[model samples]
Target: MTYDRCLATLKAISGREAASGYSQRALKQVFGTSKVTFPLSYDRQEFFSKSVEYSKGISISGVQEKLSLRLDRASNELVVTRNNGEYILKPSPEAFPNAAENEHAAMLASQKIGIETALCTLVPFKTGELAYLTRRFDRLESGDKRPQEDLLQIGGLPPKAKYDVSYEKAGELVDQATGGKRAVKLDLFRRVLFAYAIGNNDLHTKNLSLQRAVESSSRFYDKLTPNYDVLFVQAFDNTKEGQFMACDLLTDPETGEEEFTEPYQEYGFYTGYDFLELGRRYGLPERAVIRAIRNQVDSQGDMIELIQSSYMPEEMKREAEVIVVGRCRAISTGIDR
Candidate 1:
């Protein structure tokens, strides 16, 4: 019931020997706790049943099963309920083995590359299963809920149409949200490029959101929320198309031909040109986008080390490394042209 070594930093997760663990102050600020273990029974069946029942009202949209939890500081435990919860916990899916580990590694990789990603960690269930834990960013220190909208809603699209828009539309949403701030636009471009480089083909509208400041007077003012739900889908899903991307970098012109055309066929596999064009559409310089891509490419070693330290199986670790390295090379080669 005690961890002598942290899975992340190789220190203690708790106990009197927890000095070198994830910084207590930083953990408290980000996750509301320095304690790594969730002080609750890890009954997978009970948890899933409760989450299914709760989804009727407090549904977190996605194919995966997730539960919102509030940390009872007095007892230092997590309860399966939506009562002002500070974290979202996702168990490994039955269909996708090692999903929690995959997501945890992906989030860590994103963070290492300087992306403002949602804080995440892997926790062990009593059943010896690992779950992905992410701190909720939509809540304030005073326990006030901040107003937030996803790209789908911001673009005036219904939830059912989440996958219908191109990635450029998200840039438009960011532009409107930040009132044409060049820095935010450039950052958005970097995020998009990062998604491509990491083989995350699931950057759908729901995955990107805008959060309004708790004290902002204007209703329209907001900023991009920390990146969430990023994963190397192609690495895990064998059935996934090799050239697939979640959203188009640009809208393809209508040829008006009745022949069958593969999605994003003209651009093929989201090359550097696609990302550069996306940046140009948002008024970001091509050199800036190239720099962003190169910066991430340079961090491949750090990314691999973090991946190795993750809880994913060794086979999966090898697969993920290959996917990441291959993508980085492809992006770098494309950009050099």
Candidate 2:
């Protein structure tokens, strides 16, 4: 909430110590300019007033309030725009505490574990509150919008049904849509494992998506889009009642029963074997499955390190670390353990 020497570093925008502000590398990546900070042309009061009118007819999905904006390199400022915006800004949701910092930290952690994530960072509003900002991966350098579709629409489901589908079914739909691309399936498997490891229980159908391949001639989108909308939901209060995963990972499709390994039944959490079973069900090779699970397990320290150095409040950072460690432990051990 307060500015420090390591603000940009803590936000995961800069890897090195940025004593003055954002490092050159980070500034180049996010702003495509030499700006020290992403100063907005509008203040918080103006943003709050204008965003309401700007949000109408905005096609972007999700429950968070979003404003589309474009970077003016000539002026070195980000300005609100109703059309052809290159970035999506998410101010902290009133209902969700520290949502902006939570998302920025989680997204960087996801990238650390090898998940392809949308380029994002935490930008300070003129009022000093931090907001989550992500570049629109669906847009090109020429300001052209790429063909992109979330899994919900691809599966012919409405927004209300986003939470109704299972990962197994979603993966199946993705396989069909992508023409059974093995690499895409493998990436999907890794993403699912990463989501669970981070205690991101909000990775429903609408969160996963595909974009049209830049080189392809086909009309269908055959490429998986970068991961987005990821954050640690367990850091919030009163969020522990639901299942571990957003979808029915433990459900037996044929029997319509939730299946749990012996350790799961005893300990009441998924073990490494459960993840292995899921990879197998998703038709990923055994070696790849083992590797993906190992990737998540091995990145435990990195995830915690990011959380500790994040812009989240101290209490929330500690809570997030505990949640991530618990999930990582759950996913690292076998059923026998």
Candidate no. 2 TM-score:
0.90
List TM-score per model, in order.
0.85, 0.90
Per-residue lDDT of 1-337 in model 2, one digit per residue for the tens?
3344344345433333343346566667866765644445566667768878898522122446778888766776788888889889887766686888888898888888888888887777766677888888988777787778899999999889887777777778888888888788888888888888877888888889999877778866677899998988778664655567887765676786566657677887777887888777778888888878877888889999999888889988988899888888888787332
User: What is the Cα-based TM-score of model 1?
Assistant: 0.85
Name the runs in model 1 displaced over 4 angstroms.
Answer: 1-5, 8-30, 35-39, 56-61, 253-268
* lDDT per model vs. reference: 0.71, 0.77
lDDT (C-alpha) at residue 176 in model 2:
82
**Which regions of candidate 2 fall more than 4 Å away from where they truly are?**
1-20, 36-38, 56-63, 255-263, 335-337
Candidate 1: tens digits of C-alpha lDDT, residues 1-337: 4445453433235664344334465456555667644434767787788887765322222557888887766766777775787788887777777888788788877887888888876666666577777888888867787789888888888878776777776787888876777887776777777777777888888888887777788756466788888876766756346555676666543742222123225644555655666777788877888888789788888878877777678888887788778777766756774
Q: Model 1: which residue pairs collide? A: 6-11
